[model samples]
Target: MTFDLRPWQLADFPAYQALITAPAIATAIGIDAKSTVSQQQAFENDLYQTYQAAILIDGVPQGSIVAYQRANELGEPLVNEADIAYFLSPAFWGHGIMTDVITAFIAQLPPHFTLWADVLADNIGSLRVLEKVGFTNHGTYIDLFGRQIIQFHLYR
Candidate 1:
């Protein structure tokens, strides 16, 4: 399967709205907002703060990937560090699409910047993907939400 990354546009909103609201995808991706409208607003804010792209397979939006300024548990932004996050539709899981997506994204990053990611310890799949893309586990810490998160970083 071919994967493409493109600048997220207003035209992609319908697909994005549908993808993030799927119960399985929402739970795994941790979008706790109750309404799609709020989620889209937050999404727009995130785009303002960082870079984001749509993950399309054969021109259909299947997921999204973003690299943005690090945010604390309470949503305070931290500069200098790029925090990467991605979510694929449940229909696309287990296909190595995310692994490929992340690898490609990493390749395009500025080598001088440090990249960071936090994964829940129980999120084995996510951890695997991070490792596969050359991220080293830094440490584990409790997040603002009170969940244990395994921190990973790639320092260039």
Candidate 2:
């Protein structure tokens, strides 16, 4: 199915929260960093300033793609290296919904050398999605769960 991505709004929190509640997704995309409505509003306000959204499907709020710019050390600045994070309702898992959404989402970003994602070690389904989309396993990180998890990168 074709999905349309939109800018995430404060009102979208209810839908986003609902998305995070999905067992499979929550295990990866993380639970609310903002635990209150006021916090959600704060995140929404900051979202636009720091991030861009490419949401999936009209009226469904099925998922979102967030992009942001960050600086690095060692003096060499990188304009690329977009870090992507996404999730879908458990019901949509294994249906290639994310594969479609990602295809659409990547096209929206400026041409860059690579796309990166940090997936929870246990989120096998997400890893498969990225791999199916041509991402290669890169390295690992100590995520919130306090365990090392693999990271993926897809070069364009």
Report every candidate's CA lDDT: 0.81, 0.70
**1-156: candidate 2 lDDT, tens digit per residue:** 666777777767777777666666555655544466644653464367444563556567877677544447874546876677776777667777888777777777777657778888777788888898899999887976696688898888
Candidate 2, TM-score vs. the true structure? 0.79
Off by over 4 Å in 1: 71-80
What stretches of model 2 exceed 4 Å from their correct place?
32-34, 37-46, 49-51, 74-77
Among these predicted structures, which one has the highest lDDT? 1
List the pairs of residues colliding in candidate 2: 4-57, 5-55, 6-55
**Model 1 C-alpha lDDT per residue in residues 18-78, reported as the tens digit of each score:** 8888887676667764787777885675456447788999889888888888767998876
Which 10 residues in a row give candidate 2 its minimum summed lDDT?
A: 38-47
> Please, what is the TM-score per model?
0.86, 0.79
Minimal lDDT window, size 10, model 1: 42-51
